[model samples]
Target: MHFLQQVINGIAQGCIYGLIAIGFVLIYKATETVSFVQGELMMLGAFLGLVLITVLGIPYWLAVPATLLAMMAFGFLVERVAISPILGEPAFSIVMLTLGIGYVARGAVMMIPELGTELQVLPVPYRDQSVAIGGLIIGMERLVVPAVTAALCLMLYLMFRFTRIGVAMQAASQSQSAAYYMGIPVRRLNGLVWGMAAGVAAIAGLLLAPIVMIDSNMGFIGLKAFPAAVVGGMASLPGAVVGGVTIGVIESLAGYLLPEGFKDVAAYVVVLIMLMVRPNGLFGGEVRKKV
Candidate 1:
């Protein structure tokens, strides 16, 4: 029973990691650059939600959609103003730029006087509430996080698999020049992908805030997502989900069965093992050389 309970906890945590990993995979697929700022974006989203629900007196239900939309627009603007102009530069340049963006985001949050310097609890109705079934107890947050993550994943799968914009995004990811030649409007799709990634990150923030305190530093959770992405396959969306669950489960088991502090490094240990065993990732396809 204790083991089962731990598994539940881990699954929820893994779902959060998976949500952030999706942001990483989305940006990488669209532009071949990883957005290290994803964690900070998650942080910013949580703060925005806090402001909406706590400061502005908005309802939690309404605050969620508003925050998501705002983050989407923020993402598009980030790409246009900061990311787009440097498209032709070296990949490392973009990477550094993203790191700078992350610092700027964190700094911006901290500059908000009262809000930035403090830890906050999102006033979700389900906060601290739990239910039990079959002699096992479960937190509402544990149940909700995985359910929402699964729903989001399904929605994304459907959109990418069925929608015209999804198809265009796919083509653009495959080869931008070729996609542009085919009239796919690759630049527009890139902006949309960035917005989509940001929106997803915001949802992740909202779901996670109730489970943990919403703080400026919560974005550091993205570090775990980085391992999840690598373990699952940086370029494979399904792989992100798999990797997240695996990491989450391992961390949970470690915290329960091993000494204290094992949970912190368990994800990275699995990542190293996965890299050694399957360098291309569980779902990553064949690598190619342009030369």
Candidate 2:
């Protein structure tokens, strides 16, 4: 029973990591650039929800849509104002820029009065509720996380598989020059991809806030999600989900069965082993570069 409980907990946390990993994969596919600020973007999303619910006294249902829209707009502005100018720069520069953005975001959150210093609780009705099945008990909030993650993954899959924009994004990812020649509006697509990624991050944040305290440093969990992305294959969306669950389960088992702090290091150790054995990730395809 205890083991089952730990597995459930791990799955819940893994779902958040999976969602964040989706953002990482999306941006990488669109621009071949990793947005180191994705975790901070998640933090910002949670803060947005906090402001809406706590400060404005908005209902949770209403706050969700409002937060998502705000995140979309924020993502659009970020791409246009910060990322677009450096589009042609070296990859390392873009990475550093994202890191700077993350730091600035975290710093700005800390500058907020009262909210920055103290941990804030998001009062969701189902936060502490749970369900029991036989000898296993599952928290509703924890169950919701993985369910939502799966639904989001399905929605994303459908968007990319059947939608025109999805096809355009796919084309652009494969070859930007060809996509542009085909009238795909690659640049605009890139911006949209960023917006989409940010929106996803927002969803991740909102879901996570109920499970953990909302704070400036909450985004650091993205570090774990990064490993999830790598283990699943950075280029594969489904792989992200798989990687997240695997990492989550591993971490959960480790935390319960092993010494303290084992769970924290489990994901990274798995990632390191995976990288040494399969550099492209479990589901990632091999890319050959012509010299």
Candidate 3:
């Protein structure tokens, strides 16, 4: 029973990692850039929800959509004003820029008068609820994360598989020049992709806030998500979720069964092993660069 409980806990935590990793994969797919700021974006989302619910006293349902929309707009603005201008720059520069953005965001959050220093709990009605099944107990908050993630994944799959805009985005991801030449509005699509990624990050933050206290440093959880993206394959969306759950389960089991700190190091150790054996990731495609 204890083992089952741990597994359930792991799965719920994994769902959070997977959700953030999906943002990583989405941006990478659209622009081939790894946005290290995803974690910060998530932190911002949670803060947004906090402000809406706590400060404004907005209802939970209304706050949810408002937070998501605000995040979507913020993402679009960041891409258009900050990221898009440097699209042709070296990849490392773009990476550094995003890192800087994250630091600035964290600093700004810290500058907030009342909210920065203290940890606050989100007022999610489902926070303390749980369900029991044959010696196994699951928190409703935990169950909600995975359910929402699965539904989001399904919606994303359908968007990519059947929608015209999705097809255009796919084409742009494959080859931007070709996509532009084919009249796909590649630049606009890039902004949209960033927006979409941010929106996903917001969802992750909202879901996570109820589980963990909302705070400026909450973005650090993105560290775990980085390994999830790598383990699953940075280029594969489904792989992100798979890798997240795997890492989550491993970490959970290690935390329960092994000595202290093993869970924290497990993600990096797995990444190191995976890189040694398969550099392209579990689901990554092999690419041959012509010299």
Candidate 4:
């Protein structure tokens, strides 16, 4: 039962990582660049939620959607103003730019008028609430995280798989020039993809805030999630989900079963093993180029 409990806890945390990993995969597919600022985006979203609820005296339910929409717009503008201009630049330059953007985001959050580098509770209604199943106590947060993550995954799958815009986005990701020639607004789609990714990251932040304090450094959680994206296959959405849960479970068991600090490095260990075994990831497709 104790072991089962740990597994459940790990699953919940893994869902959070999965959501963030999905954000990473989204941008990668849309723009072929790994945005290193996802963590900061999540942090900013959480902070924005905090501001809306506490500072602006907005209702929690209303504030939630509002925050998501606002972050989406923020992401759109970011892509248009900063990322879009360097679409064909060297990969190293793009990555370094993303890292700089992350730093700017973090610093911007810390410089906010009323909320700066301080730990604050989000005051969510679900905070400190939990339920028991089969004699095991589970927090509402643990339950909410997985449920929401599943819902988002399904919605995204449907969108990308069925919607016209979704097919267009996929086309643009495949080749910008071809997409543009086909009359698909590749630049516009890229901005929308960035917006959507930011919105997803905001959802992650909101869902996670109740489980942990909303803090400037909370975005560091993204660092942990990066392994999830890699292990799952950066190009596969479902792989990201599976990889996150796998990493989360391993970390949970390691925390209890392994000696000393094994929990901290467990995700990386899994990544290394996965890389050695399946370089294309569990669900990732093979890539080929004719020389």
lDDT of 2 by residue, 117-196 (tens): 68999887787798989968787888889988989999999999999999889989998888978888888888899999
Which residue pairs come into collision in candidate 3? none
lDDT by residue (tens digit), candidate 3, 1-291: 898889988998998899899989999989999899889999999999999999999999999999999999999999999999999899999999999999999999999998987898899989789998996778899899999999999999999999999989988998888897898899999999999989999999999998889899999999899999999889999999999998898899999999999988988888899899998888888884344
**lDDT for every model?**
0.91, 0.91, 0.92, 0.89
Candidate 4 lDDT over residue span 164-202, tens digit each: 999898888777778989999889999999999899899
TM-scores, in order shown?
Answer: 0.97, 0.97, 0.97, 0.96
As a whole number from 0 to 100, the lDDT of residue 194 in candidate 2 is 91
Worst 10 residues of 3 by lDDT: 282-291
| Model 4: colliding residue pairs | none
Q: Which ten residues in a row have the lowest lDDT in candidate 4?
A: 282-291
Per-prediction RMSD in angstroms? Answer: 1.2, 1.3, 1.3, 1.4
lDDT per residue, candidate 1, 98-197, as tens digits? Answer: 9899989998898999889888898998877889899997989889999999999999999999999998898888778889789887887888889998
User: Which residue runs does candidate 2 get wrong by more than 4 Å?
Assistant: 288-291
Worst 10 residues of 2 by lDDT: 282-291
Model 1 lDDT at residue 203: 92
**Steric clash count of candidate 1:** 0
Looking at candidate 3, what is the lDDT of residue 270?
A: 83
Cα deviation in Å at residue 200, candidate 1? 0.7
C-alpha lDDT of candidate 3 relative to the true structure: 0.92
